[model samples]
Target: MSTGQATLPLLNTTLENCRMVIIGVDPHKDVLVAVAVDGNGRQLALRDAPARPRGYKTLLAWTAQFEQRLWAVEDVRHVAGGFVRCLLAAGESVVWVPTQMSSDYRKKVRASGKSDPIDALACARAALAEDLPAAVPDTEARNVKMLLDHREDLVGEMVRMCSRLRWHLHDIDPDFAATIPKHKLHRPKWNKSVQEFLARQAGSVAVAICVELIGRIQELAQRAAQLEREIAALVVIHVPQLLALEGCGPLSAARILAETGDVRRFTSAAAYAMHTGTAPIPASSGNTHRVRLNRGGNRRLNAAIHRIAITQKRMHEPARTYLDNRRAKGNSNTEAIRALKRHLARRVYALLKNGPDHAQADTTVQAA
Candidate 1:
C-alpha cells in the first residue's frame, strides 16, 4: 500500500489484447472464497476452499494452469500471506487491489448485497480494465512482516497490562507518578526489579494492590523481550544496512523495512520520498505556486525518516547546516525536522536505487 505520490502513467497499454486473469480471494477465519475471470471479464470459475492447506493448494493449481498477464487479488496487507506466497512461487504477475478499491467498485457496479462469486467477478473485471493497483514488494518482506506484526502484538499486550498496573498503583500510592516514570517499564531486564518494588510497596499498602501490578508487569516484560529478540533476528537478515545507519537500531530499522517492502519499486528518490510522506506537495493551481508539506503516504515511514534526520543533525556538517538554515528562516523545530526528513528520505532512496556512488554524487551536488 506504500506508494510515492509521483503517479506514473499507466503502462498497461501494451496489455490491451493480452489475456489477463484475476483470482478474487475473500479470506476469512476458516475459509477462503475465490473466483476467477478471464481477460475479457468473463467468469470462469468459482469455489469455496479451506483457508489452509486444501484452499491454498486449489488456488495454486488454478494459478499454474491459467495464462494470466495480471492476477489481481485483494489487499495482502492484513491477510493473504499464503495466497501471495503461492502466486509468487509460481512466478505469476500478481497485483494487489486494495480492499477499499474493490469495495468501491462493488458499490458502483452492483449497488446491492454481494456474494463471493459476484465480488470475485467484480475484482476480475477491475483487473481486466486496468483498475487494479500494483502489488507492493517488500525488501525483507517475510521477516519484516513477522517482526512488525509481533512487535505490534507485544505493544498492545503491554498497553493492556499497563492499564491494569496503573489501576493497582492508584489504589496503593497516590503519589506514585511523582517518584517513578510516567510510563510503565516495558523491558524484560527491568521486570524483576519492578516486581520486587511492587511486592515491597504492596506489603505496606494493606490492599495487596502491588502484588497484581508486579505480576502483570512481569508478564508484559516477557512478551516484550520475546518481540525484541524476534525483531533483532529479523534485522540481522533483512535490514542489516538499515541497522548500520546511525540511530536506526534493530527496532526502528525493522519498522522502516516493514513499511517499505521494496525500495526498488520506486522509480526515483523523489518518488520514494513522496510515498513516505516526506516529499512536499506543490500547491500551484494557476500562478500561486508553493510546495506545502504532504499529509498522505505511509505515516510510519515518515516517522522513521524524521528519526533518521534528527540523528543526522548531530555530528554531521551538512545536516547541521540544513537544520540551522531552516531555523533561521523562522521554521519551528518540528517544521525544520520535517524538511530534513524529506531530504533524508531522498538520500535513503538514492542509496537503495543507485548505491553509494550515485548517492554520494547526489549529496555532493546538493551541498554545492
Candidate 2:
C-alpha cells in the first residue's frame, strides 16, 4: 500500500530531539486506517490496510521505518483485538486510546468532516497528550472474562425462556401456573416439576412449545452452572485473598479479577479507586469546596464493588460498623455506602497487587 504525506511539517526542536513516533489506528471489520505522527503530533504519513493477517504483516513492515514507534489504538476491543494481539506478539509497544478522548480531540480539531483518517489523527494526538496505559497480552483475566460473560448470556436466555414458558403455562392451566413459584424456574426441583406437568398435558402446539422452552432453559442452566464452577476455580487460584474478604463471593471475586486485569499496572490504590469510579469527582467553586459522585470509569467494575458494599451493609459486622461511623459523622446512607465502596476498592487493589503472597498467606491462615 502507498503512504500519503501530510502537509504539516515537524518544526519543534524539542519534539524532534525526542525522536518518538505514534501511529494511531482507526480499526474496522474489513479495513484499518492508520495515521503516523511525530512526537509533536505532526502527521508524517497515513495508510490504509485490510484487516487480515497479510495486512497486519504489511502494516508491521511499513511501521518498521519508524524505529521508536508506539501504536495508539482506539479501545474498541471487539474490532481491534486481533490486531492488538498481533502487534503485542510482534513486541511492539502499544497503548489503548479511549474512544471518548479521541472523539473529543476530533471535535476540537475544526476538521471539515469526519472520516477514518480524522479519527485516526485524533487517536494519535490524544495519545501524544495523555499518559495512557500500555496494552498487554491477554492472560487468565481474559479467559475468566469470557467465561463470566458467557454465563451471563446463558442466564439471560434462560430468563427469557422461563418467561415464555410461564405465559404458556398460564394460558394452558392458570391453576398450575399459580402453583409454580416465581423466580425459581431454574431450580432443579422446580424445573423437574414443570417437566412432569408438561408430560401430563395433552399433546398440542403450545404444550410442545412449552416442552421445548423448558428443555432449552434446563440446558442453559446446566451450562451456566458449569461456567460458574470453572470461574470460581479460576478465582480461587488467581485471587483467593479476594474471597477471604467478608462480602466478596466467588463470582464477585471473579468479576474483580476479570475487570481489573493486572492491577499492578495501576501506580497506587488511589489510581485503582479512580478506575473503579469509587473516587469522588471534585466539583468545587472557590470557597464552596465540595466533591460529587463519580459517574465515570469502568461501570461494571463499579457495579461489582457496589454489590460487595450492599452485601457488607446487610451482613458484615465490620462493614456495618464502618457505615455507622460514617453516618455518625453526618454522611447520608448513600454517601456512607459510596465511601465504603471506595474503601473496598483500595482493599481489592492491595489484594490484586499482592495476589500470590496474599493467596498463600490466606490459605495458610485458614488451614491453621
Candidate 3:
C-alpha cells in the first residue's frame, strides 16, 4: 500500500475476472475527479470532469478508451448520487466504497499533498483491496424513506410554529398560551387582545401573522397525518411481516426498510448487524475474554433497533422473558438490551429479505 506499490497480488488474483480498469470517482458539487487504475492498482488514466450531464458523458467517453471498466464511487448519498445513478443507468457495474475508505488510505496512497486526483487515486487503490457491495437502486424503499423524511420535517416545522405562537401568547396573555392545543396548535379561546386589535384595525398585522402561522401549523398536521397513512399502506404492501412483529410499527418498518436497502448486499446477518452498529467488539486479553459495544455501524440503524428492543421488552412476552433470563444470568440492563438489539437486528435482516418470517426473539440468544 505504499505510494507507488501497485500490484495487489492478493486481490488481483481473486479479481482476475474483473474489468481491465477500475474508475475511481471523487465527486464534488462543482466538479469531479476520476482515476482509472489496473487490477494491480497501477495508475492508468486520470481526468477532471464537470459535475453535469456533459461532464458525465465526457468522463464516460474518456473511460471508454480503456478496454473494460468498473466504477468505484464514494458512498455519499446526495453528492455522488448523480454520478452513480448515471453509471448505473448506462448498464455499467458500480461499486460503492465508503467515503471514509479513501480517507483511511490517503496517507499511504498519495505522493505529496492531497487533492481531488490524489483522493481519486486513493479510492482506486482501496477498491482493489476490497470487493465492495454493488449499488442497487430500490425505488419503493427510496420512496418510503423520502416520505419519512418529509414527515419528520413537517413535525419539526410544527414544533417551531407552536413555539413561536407560544412565545407571542406568553407575552400577550399567559393563560391563553397555556390553552394553546399541544397537538393542533389552536388559537387561544380567550384571545380578546387579538380580536380587539383586529377589530380596531390597529396592529392587525400581528393577528394576520399569528393566524397565518396557525393555519400553516394546522395544515402541516393534516399533511403529516396523510403521510403516515400513506407510509403505513406502503409498509404493509412492501413489508407486512415487520408490522406483524409486536414492536415494529409503520414508521419503524419504513425506517428499517429504507435504511437497510436490499439486504442481499449484506453477506449475512452478522454483516447486517455490523452495519447496525450493534456488533460486539473484542475487549479481551490474557485468560479473560469479553466484548464491548460497537460504536461503529450506522447509529440510525442502531437507534431503530434500540426502539424495537425497548418496545418488545415492554409488551412482547417472549422478548421480556428472554430479557429476564439474561438478567438472571448476571447481565446488566445495558448488556441485556445490547444482546436484544443484536437479536432484533438479525431478525429484521431476515424479515426484510422475504416476508412473514417465523424468526423469534428467543431464536437470537447467544452465550455470554
Candidate 4:
C-alpha cells in the first residue's frame, strides 16, 4: 500500500517536538495487523503478528525504536481485550478508537476498498485527531458484566423452555394445565407438582419431552439464582450506596456498574447522563427553547435507569412529589420520567465516584 498523507492536519509544534508515535492495531482471531504513524499522520512502519503472547512481545520489541508511543486499538472487546491486557501489563499507554470513527476516517482517506492495514491506519489517524478514553484493565466491572450476562442468558433459556413446556402440558392434559399458573412453571413448588403429575401420566413422547424440559428448566433456574447471588455480593462490595437508593435493587445496580465501567471516565455527572441517554438533546428554534428525548448512548444502561425511575414513581414519596411538581409545570408523564432518569443519573454517578462511606449521607432522592 502507498504511504499516502493522512487527511488530517499536521500536529502542532508542541506535539511534533514530542515525537509521539501512535500504533494502531486491527485485531482478528488469529493475527493482528498494526500500523505506526507519527504526529503528522504519516505511516512509518507496518507489521503483522500472531494474536498471542509471543506476538505481543514481538510488537513490543518492534515498537521500542520509538521512545514515545501510544497504542490505538479498535474498540472490539472480544478480539482486542487480551491484546490490550497484555499491553497494559507491560506499562504501555493505550486508548480505544471506536469502530465507527475509524471506519469514517478510512472512508475519508481511502478512495475505495478496505483491508486490515487500511483499517489499522484509520484507527491511528482517528486517535490522533480525537480525544478518546484511555484504556484501563478489565476490573470488577468485567466480572459483574460477565455474571449478569450469563444469568440473563439462563433466564432467557428458561423462558423459552417454559413456553414449550406449557404447550406440551396443554396437549397432554388441558385441565391440569389450567390448574397451574402460566408464570409459575419455573418455581420449585410448581416444578415439584409438575414432576408428580408427569410421574402419574402414561409414558408417551409428549410426556417424555415435558419431563426433559422441566429438568432443564429447574437446572437453569438454580444456576441463574447462583449467578444472581454472586452478582449481589459484588454490588455490595463495589457500590452499596447505589443499592441504598430507593428503587435501586441489586440487579439494577449491577447493570449500572457494569455499563458505566468506571464513572471517572466521564468528566462530570452531565457527561454520565449523556452516556445513559437521559440527557435531553437541544431541539430549539429561533426565539424558542426546547429539549427533546435522546435516543443514543448505551440503551441497556438507559433501560436499567428507566426501571429505577418506574419503581420510584410507583412507591417512593419524594419521587412521587417530584413527578407531581413536573406534571404541575405542564410536563407530561413521559417528560416527568425522563427528568427523573436524568436526576438518577447524577445520583448514581456520585455514588460510584464516592463509594459507600462518603455517599451514606445522601442516599435518598431529594425533591428537586
Top lDDT model: 4
How does each model score on lDDT?
0.64, 0.83, 0.75, 0.86
Count residue pairs with overlapping backbones in model 4: 0
Ranking by TM-score: 2, 4, 3, 1
lDDT of 1 at 236: 72
User: On lDDT, who's better, 1 or 4?
Assistant: 4
Q: How well is each residue in 58-121 modelled by candidate 4, as lDDT tens digits?
A: 9999999999888999878788899999998998878777677788889976547899999999
Candidate 2 lDDT over residue span 208-279, tens digit each: 999889888989999999999999999888888888787789899888888888775566788678778899
lDDT of 3 by residue, 64-173 (tens): 88777778877766788778888878867777766666777677884878888888888777777765556666568888988998999999988898778667656655
For candidate 1, the lDDT comes to 0.64
Q: Over 4 Å off in model 3, which ranges?
A: 1-21, 37-45, 65-69, 99-115, 118-131, 175-208, 328-331, 356-368
Worst 10 residues of 4 by lDDT: 5-14
Candidate 3 clashing pairs?
Answer: none
For model 4, give the RMSD to the true fold.
Answer: 7.2
Q: Which stretches of candidate 4 lie over 4 Å from their true place?
A: 1-22, 35-47, 65-67, 97-131, 174-183, 292-295, 327-332, 366-368
Off by over 4 Å in 1: 1-18, 22-24, 33-48, 57-66, 98-141, 184-209, 222-230, 233-238, 244-246, 262-283, 290-299, 310-317, 323-342, 353-368
Total backbone clashes of model 3?
0
Name the weakest run of 10 consecutive residues (lDDT summed) in model 3. Answer: 5-14
